[model samples]
Target: MVNTRTTDYWSQFIVDYSGGGDFFIANAYGKSAAQLSYDRVLFGSALQVVENIKLINNIIVVDLPVSAFQGLSLSPDDRAFYQVIADNQHLTGYEDLSSAFRPKKRIRRVDGPYEAEYFDGVYSAEKVRFIKLSRKLIEGELQVGVVVYLAQTLQSRNEMAHDISVKALQLVSVIFTIALSVCYVFIWFIVRPIRRLNTVLSERAPTDLTPIDTDAPKEISELLRTINHFMMQLQNTLDRLKHFTSETAHQVRTPLAGILAQSQNALMENDKPKRHSQITQVIDSCESLSRTVDQLLNQALLAHRFKSKALEKVWLGALIKEVSRDQVLTALQQKVELAYIGPNDDCQIVGDTVALKKMLQNIIENAIKYSPKQGVVEITLIIEKNREINDIRPRYGHS
Candidate 1:
């Protein structure tokens, strides 16, 4: 489209120049027939072209010898106009002239307006464009071809286009900068609090399970709350561990000291019976100490499992039977009869199996221990419908 428009202006200019030649003939209307005939050929067949604010002072015929247009060719000192036609033969036809001129040769679309030089003429090249125009004419009985070239320099249009482009680029750059700044501000607000939390956490000692204090957004505040909850749990666990360690040391020390004393007593005794009794006491003390250690270990394991939320379905009848069997020998030694009674159907309940078994065992054993000689330690599983017991106490009765 740009090429077409460029060629159009040049073509219009050529037509205008030809009209000027016709006016010249009109002024010499009263001349002789031979002169009028010559003027008609000159005005009708002559190619009128303009370039760089100057008229085309030279002309040439393509197929004919250079001498044919001798007077017309010698009119211009600058042969550049003729040189353009000789280089592009397609510019000879009126129809092909618009399409033949390539933008690369004569037209340049620049980023900004600047000065342009053409045909020894310097003009503001801002929006200036060049085009080639051509047409066919009749000279007597022969068909002659005429070509014209022209330049259209537009300073106002170039300045407008350049100004619009600059403003558009500036607007895009401003928006991009604002978007980047907002993202940076958002990231800083989010990351700053997290970094503070990390610092507080990293500076704590291994044993320091204290809750943390954080001044942060709601989301970060929730995260801190979870951390504090876990820290409280850890503190509780640590306290339990300390208490268990001290109790174990105290409980273990007594039986161990008694065992040592029994050993020394056994060594001093000369009589076989006396020595045997001392050895028996030492064995009993050792067994009791072992039982205490086992109970303490099992308690620790139960606490750990509960902390992990480990639970399972347990049958009350089966659990009671198992505990009674384990305590049967102990009950026999204490001269007590251990018995278990349960419903025909198994009573199922959800709880930690290890903890439940230990609880039943401790209760039955205590009952047997406190019972009189020849007393019965009868265990019963009583199922109460729609009742949840908040507290329970074990009682023993001698029969």
Candidate 2:
């Protein structure tokens, strides 16, 4: 038996006597091989195997011609490695030895960073060689076989390593597949939520400019915020345009009605004295239409000027008073009152002065037209925490 810490040399001795294990019940004898005084026992099975086995220098040796080796080409280095194996005696020293084999100090291989395997097993192709013993049973019942030690080589070890590497790579392939599955599922978790968020944003209600609650995953929040800001501006611009259009419609339609009325009345009159008055009425109606069109044009032009953003500091009270005074003649003709209610003291404000002047003209003219004769049109200015529109009211339309 081979001990856990020691391979039995007695195991080799048993081969010289033609046996596998050192112990056996003798078929018809007084003792077993285990009880024998010598390490080896001569058996009837030995004679049958004796001729088939080869021994040289008391070292057992064997050579096998393999069909697989015959078909392959050998490198010069590998050829040299095989020659060293055939010439090596240390591996075959057991064949000629008369005395029982002794346990050897293990040999270390200098060239191998690779693993070395020793085979003392029965019928191992690379290590032990077995042969038939006379094709016959021996000692009335014992079956016999030949055993020998073969040479070792770097080439042989290389072949085994290649096979083992292939098996290891196959195991790694399985692990790689499992890892890919995990990654695919993780990415799916990420894309699914993003797709859902995209659907929600694109499908938003048309009437609702309310900011979308994207619940964005840290990554897209800044984009969502920008989208929301744009939506707010768009909503505000649309509202302003709607109100402007309604006001413009009202302003334009009134003059058109007056012109229609004047023309009809003039057409009905035959006297030259009455004809002159009707023509004057038509002329006045045309003037009102012209002023409304001019104001609208000025508003458009001023809006273009505002884009330059050259808002300079100008005196607010003076700016308003200048525009109102210029239009006082028109106000008087309409039998409406015009006045500045603000502090006559200088109050400087930051704005485009030209645009502000135009704004005041439009506002003041609106007040004069809507107010009754002797109505008080007061423009009050306050220099306070901020510019307060409440401090002044054009009593014409907004009573």
Candidate 3:
């Protein structure tokens, strides 16, 4: 059997067979009237010439079927035909979509994925398949707008899906950003107050039992309670330390003083050089022991005053003068010269008067002890003017 391709039946037969309208032909072959008629009806559409053109391949080509051209001249049917094609959401089968298909047959279903070219919009899953087939069966290549034509009725649906996706993404992004901001603020509120409390705890306050502003960020209430608990422990430790030092000093100082006095008296009574040397060594040992006890007592007193914050304000000048006066007699006994060089008038400083007196007396007594016979010990008090008054404890060092 001879295979005929692309029909070209005569006009008179085209008019008779096609209800007397326009015609189009498929390219490349001549066939008997009987054969073309069988081919056309079998193909499900009639073939007639709408345009007759010569092909470089030495073939005459006429495109589409007679019915298509017949409807093209009828303006009302033209739009309806296009509309029907667009609404006809039917797949052209997988065989047409397959890359290898190159059929000599031209009349096939123009409903598939290829219709995207006619309508440049997104398509429904069913509609997308229809346009895909249309391009393979009719236009012979996949086209951009062809898919659009098949799926155009479903354009609103595609747009709605797209908008929903974008809106959902935006909502997620906004929610995350809001959550992050809230978390940042929450943490800052918790940390800032706790940090302030930490600063206060580290500093040397006047007392062990002194109450601090316990208010803090509410988020970490447990952490604040822990710090308060630690503070209580610290106060207990300080109290124990102060009591121990005071008790130890009292216990050891009285006996040491008695021993020092007895040693001094024995040193004077001993006439033998060897005996005098032994007595002097004993006196030195007693003196050293007394000094150590005095130091411990003084430190314990200072700690106690710090705990109570009972350090009273006194005239620094009167304080200095009293220490100087006491030192004069000691200086005279030691055969050392004592002098003062500072402000003429009273200078006020906030501190415990007793502790201040003791401190000043200790310094002067030390000066008298260390200075050579007939040496001058100068005591100076410098007053700095400032709004906030503080105790200027003078530290003496030998250069």
Best by TM-score: 1
Over 1-399, each residue of candidate 3 has an lDDT whose tens digit, in order, gives 533322213322332343311111211111123233322222222112211211324322334445634422332211111211122342222222222222343234432222121222223222321222222122333222111111113233333333343344445447768999999998887688878877877784658555466676566577777766777878887778878867886778776776777676676765687667757767777777777778777877876776676666688887787789877888889888887776686776678887778878887888788887778887777666773234334333332
Model 2 deviation from the true structure expressed as Cα RMSD, one decimal place: 20.4
Clashes of 3: 35
Q: What is the TM-score of each candidate against the true structure?
A: 0.53, 0.38, 0.35
Cα lDDT of model 1 by residue, 260-342, tens digit: 99999899899999999999999999999999999999889888989986578877778778888999899899988877755
Query: In terms of TM-score, which candidate is stronger, 2 or 3?
Result: 2
Best by lDDT: 1
Rank all candidate structures by their TM-score, best first, as comma-separated numbers: 1, 2, 3
Please give the lDDT score at residue 362 for candidate 2.
79
**Candidate 2 — which residues are off by over 4 angstroms?**
1-187, 300-399
Q: In model 2, where is the ten-residue run with the lowest total lDDT?
A: 37-46
Give the C-alpha miss distance for residue 267 in model 3, angstroms: 14
